[model samples]
Target chain A: MSVSSQDIPTAAISRLVIYLRILEALEAAEISRTSSSDLAERAQVTAFQVRKDLAYFGRFGTRGMGYTVPLLKRELMRVLGLNRTWNVVIMGMGRLGQAVANYPGASDYQFGYVGLFDIDPELVGREIRGLKVQHADELKGFVQTRPVDLGFLAVPPEHAQAAAQTLVSAGIRGILNFAPTMIQPRLIPGSSEVESEWKAVSVENVDFLAGMKRLAFYTLNPHLRPSELKPSELSSTELEA
Target chain B: MSVSSQDIPTAAISRLVIYLRILEALEAAEISRTSSSDLAERAQVTAFQVRKDLAYFGRFGTRGMGYTVPLLKRELMRVLGLNRTWNVVIMGMGRLGQAVANYPGASDYQFGYVGLFDIDPELVGREIRGLKVQHADELKGFVQTRPVDLGFLAVPPEHAQAAAQTLVSAGIRGILNFAPTMIQPRLIPGSSEVESEWKAVSVENVDFLAGMKRLAFYTLNPHLRPSELKPSELSSTELEA
Candidate 1:
């Protein structure tokens, strides 16, 4: 609680997840203690960055022994707000939505799959991965009645904004938007005095197009990787930037 | 070729795509001659960062006038290797694979969907979005006879590494992996005296689990965003870091 969320960089928060993944793997491999340098190597980040990102949350790394795998992993879990189970729903039970619903990693991260939804009538009564596909129209009512901490927008690009609006009205605070379009945090107009206040939510997009665009850049410019560049000119320059 | 890809930061590459999108949207909306500060607000990055990221490619921002719309967009297109169309294939007919095959953003980014391949006998020869699904075994033969710049790996987690190896042996360079697993760079053993060598391929994974984790963090700690934070300390530190 000492460190406000605003105190940490969003990039650091993202890197923390990567660190958590790496630490989890190392812990599974029975590695007890590791240095920031080693962790930096696995994470493709600098030692100073690894240390600085961790330092904001308090000292997880000992001066000499580096970071204890289990201890650091626990700290990251709490920092990432993954210490508790998050009930989630997948809107738009399309192929992508189905894939997300059945994705195996969700359980590992404690994301509980509670509901499946779609706007199409044909998909409404269908069963996907043991959950019945509810109408997209029911989203607000369902969320108001049930506990859904997160929503996954796997709808088509054209339907994305509408789907996001539905989720917002449903009181979804967190959204993992797979739709190609970037969903901005907008004010939802209130109808009455009781609801005139505005609400803003968090949206994280898992855009493979951006990933592919990055791949295209790296593939076309393989020589650009920092490791292959001149040490003095490359290391501190971009890392600091 | 004037700027080595290494000289430009990878983070900048990611931002360039965002800038490209923002610029494209502006172009579509008939806006021209926007400043770095305005671009920064739309892209959610710092004005200095917008300039610094662009400076790596070439000077796009004018001393006071900011950037000309079409010129900057054209330069970014060239720098991102988006000037040419990339022939691509999706190597799975599964739910996620089908969705990727149907993803509309690829065309907007100059990625041409050339082929679809899957290992399932039933899926073979089936037309998905008008492209015939070829057997996975035919990948090497097809690539040898044709040109494929990228591949989308949407196979099950267990088959990801092997599928990636197959794509590599087929000489495909870029891959956007959708499996809920991390595919690392590994030694690929080639058969026979003429082919007894190992090669590496670039992979970008679109893991929603990571996105969801980030969402959970923000949902739990909403005060982190710059707009919500106290105006003082949240400005430059993380942006530079």
Candidate 2:
């Protein structure tokens, strides 16, 4: 079966990433084959839910047997566009930005930090994790010379919008915003709101504060955890779990 | 309307967080009343979705009138358990932990950093944002002296489980795990598999790598974006949008 991006639910895509992690763990343990039930238990969802999620892309497992772990892992990786390395640039080299730049997981996932930018005069010209921090004004010139696939917005909330605009103007494909504020696609100078080019720029937000709020809710209501719910209940409320 | 934790969908809870953020923006702009359409536009979801999500909590709006911004925001804060301050401690005082400890947003939401812990001797006794880093072994003693509602797990993947166990043993109510690894509640000593006490410890995972992967997929297939989808199409697949 052929697959289009719209054919899959956004939650399924997030779960695919989780499924890929499970497959990686299984591979490390030298496990070759797995069933939907195995994945469901580890993913904290139902077996049928796992099958339905994978079915959106294509078929994989046998009726009585199971799925080939490595094969499914490869397919999921390919679907998520993780098979290749992504060159990244960090905007606003604050503590969070510098920490992400030095993070070991970035290299593990092939997310290379090619350039770093900061507006602070003291931070500019300083070297961090081998790459020299350049002034934010130098972003456009730096991007023209080097292809940056993803731009990380780690600036304060007040500066997030301008930083995002700079990334979009610099022709960056995607943004992983770490700011607490929401970044919207404002109308370009000569373009109508409907035809704005900024719409083409993909943005994904990462908020530890939001995660903490979820934790707070769960802490207040531990009896209602998605992972610990019954299988029948799992199917009914598994959205974004 | 009576509301149980199980009555609400996990995705709805997440949307409530988003809605709360939007309400905060409205209040900041001095807006008093706002309609579902107004919230829907900013949140990038259908107005019907906003109505349905709020319905899970209780009645808030009238037939023709909109919601009171501050009132709705206060209700959401209560539902999300964010009304009171949560005393938090940071585990694994590496760069990520230090950044989180020093992040200004922490104070904005009342996530006070009470204590900092690390395995490294060099880091121990060092100060970050007015809190001195303590050795990991002192967590039990520290918790006994003061209340620690949340624990931020910023350790590497290899050490995540041990650190998580330490947090659980210290009676931390919740954990915001920043490690890339999956932290499971293994069976505690003398407890049956199903009766493990660790299950009571709430854990929320924050993976910037997973967010980056989502960015990759969206970059590859911007045409299938959830926010840009038609209203008719949105209701069908807004499972986790």
Which has the greatest lDDT?
2
Error of 2 at B63 (Å): 3.4
Over all chains combined, what TM-score does candidate 1 have?
0.88
Maximum-DockQ candidate: 2
**lDDT of all the models against the reference?**
0.76, 0.79
lDDT of 1 by residue, A1-241 (tens): 4565456778888898998987776676677666787777667778889888888887776576567778989999998888999999999888778777877678987898889899889899999888899998888888878899999999998888778878877788788899888765532222543122223578888877788878887778766744421212212211211
Which docking band does candidate 2 fall into?
acceptable
TM-score of chain A of each: 0.86, 0.86
Best by TM-score: 1
- Per-residue accuracy of model 2 over A100-180 as CA lDDT, tens digit each: 887667677678889999999999999998999999889999999978899999998888887888888888879999987
The DockQ for candidate 2, computed on C-alphas, is 0.49
